[model samples]
Target: MNLLEAFKQTKFQLSGHGNRNIKVLKDAFEQMDEQQESDMYGSGKIIEEFQDKLASYLGKESAVFFPSGTMAQQIALRIWCDRKGLKKVAYHPLSHLEIHEEDGLKKIHHIEPVLLADKNSVIELEDIVGMDEDVSCILLELPQREIGGQLPSYETLESISTYCREKGIKLHLDGARLYEITPYYKKTAAEISSLFDSVYVSFYKGIGGIAGAILAGEKDFIEESKSWKRRYGGDLISLYPYIVSADYYFDKRSQNMDEYYEGAKTLARLFNECEGISTLPLEPVSNMFHVHFNHSKEKMEQILIQLYEETGIGLTHYLNKTGEHSCYYEVSVGDRLAAIPIEELRNVFNLLNEEIKK
Candidate 1:
């Protein structure tokens, strides 16, 4: 059966609703009315209101919406670099900007990225303090996504913030999954965002929005980004659909992020106890973690198909292979996983282990 068909038939799933159906998405936009209007090249009422709510939630003086996180971060870095007269921006090696953006910062914006820390570990305050090069900004991803969603200590962040302020380096947050990590840090999004000069948040990831990102900062900074957005061909004529979907999902699912975080740890614990499986980072620091298994990626895919066919549970959509018999897959715990009984989760893990052991 096709993967989408499999997911459609499953009663329980292990990840968030990232791969939701078109019908489900269509329902999210049913509230659009005749009175509803589109933003006119970034000047519409709905987009403005959406930006205001994001700015308020992020505790920034102003905010601008972007079509994608790529546009948001690139524009933010360019603004900082233009003001500072320095082209260098520091970030972790595995950061989305570094690895996923196709070097857009360097090729398009002329911003040089200095990779910080080892790929396996989170960026540290010591690394920031020790860096001697002049940089316009330093970017940090809370709950580092590439490394099993690990976050640095609050004390460490304070130290880095203090150093950046003293050094005149703008601190930018790639808070794509900001809501997902709120439960782990025991802090509000605004409190954490306060530490940075500019913050870029995604509407899609943990917020479950359709697709978009928000860049918030002091009035002048975001205003500069607004011009940059136009320059980058990102000023969409109408963004009301994306804006409304973001608003609805944040209201509906964002409140339960804490439950998702706790449930992630719970599920990781159960997975670790199973045979031929290990949860990267052992204890989950956010609503996601990496599960390593002694099998090929193809073998794991077969296992997922078998389990879904027989038990009506879709364990995971994809797995990353590391070695000949070593593979890993990210397990995202969300409302879907939380809705399932813990004993069923346990039974599924036990069955998975039994297959891998055989």
Candidate 2:
């Protein structure tokens, strides 16, 4: 099936989710060769340079690149726990480290995650204040992706950061979607990252690159992570393609995240104005959000199939809290969606409603 057809066969998706405009192998190779080409395969000078540049951009002293965010974050927590001589890392109940990662942090790092918030809310200072002691680090995602891209209030975030500092707890940001959030928060990446002791940004998320993640922190923390990376088998031979594409995408689209925020708001507004649909988290925190439908799963599936077969639209399925109900679904707005007019998308919303009426 074509890309759009493949998407529609699964679920009704009005959200621009997933990476797009990824640099092809040819394009990535060309970009890599633009610099002095070297065949010595490994995370060498080129890869190290990319890490340094990314760390500087994120306002950290050093960074280490990994094959996946799962590895990068687990290692970050392990290092924090080791340094602080504590076993618990505080995070939201819905943080990627808790829900996603397949329990990697608990299994591999041997670190306990103190889930601090409920499913819908971002972790706040109130959540942390209840914890008395023995927490090594606080892991906060800027926009909680699973909760329909929700974010804590700015003042609340500062309060939480200050509280962590006063309590002698390190703060590590799971910034998988950090780029998409800066525009909505009216903050630069460095400014948001400055509040936390360490920050991790994914190359493949908003930057539209292939699989890779960067963990940024102090020089000592990063140096320790290097040994841990080697221990975990993340030392890839050569990250040329991943690095080149990440650099290109970050350089090109880093400035346009504001445009993406505007488009996402426009799309969310259209969906909110339409009947038969409700948006999760009440508002768009980033370029991602969820759309809960009143229709049944069968009806949703039919609508998706029809849209993809008729109109080349890509979408993904949604899972309910109990994993049994499937009526509701999610939409992720990204760079590819900037071209589609908000009014045109509203027409699809009307179509979905009309289909439900039938």
TM-score for each model: 0.95, 0.89
- Which parts of model 1 have CA positions greater than 4 angstroms off? 1-9
Question: 47-134, model 1: which lDDT tens digit per residue?
Answer: 8888999999999999998989999998898889999898999999999988898989999987889888999999998888878788
Query: How well does candidate 1 match the true structure in TM-score terms?
Result: 0.95
How does model 2 fare in lDDT?
0.76
Worst window of 10 by summed lDDT in candidate 2 = 317-326
Give me the candidate number with maximum TM-score.
Answer: 1
Global CA lDDT computed for model 1: 0.85
lDDT digits (tens) for residues 36-74 of candidate 2? 653233356778888889898999999988888889988
Clashing pairs in 1: 39-44
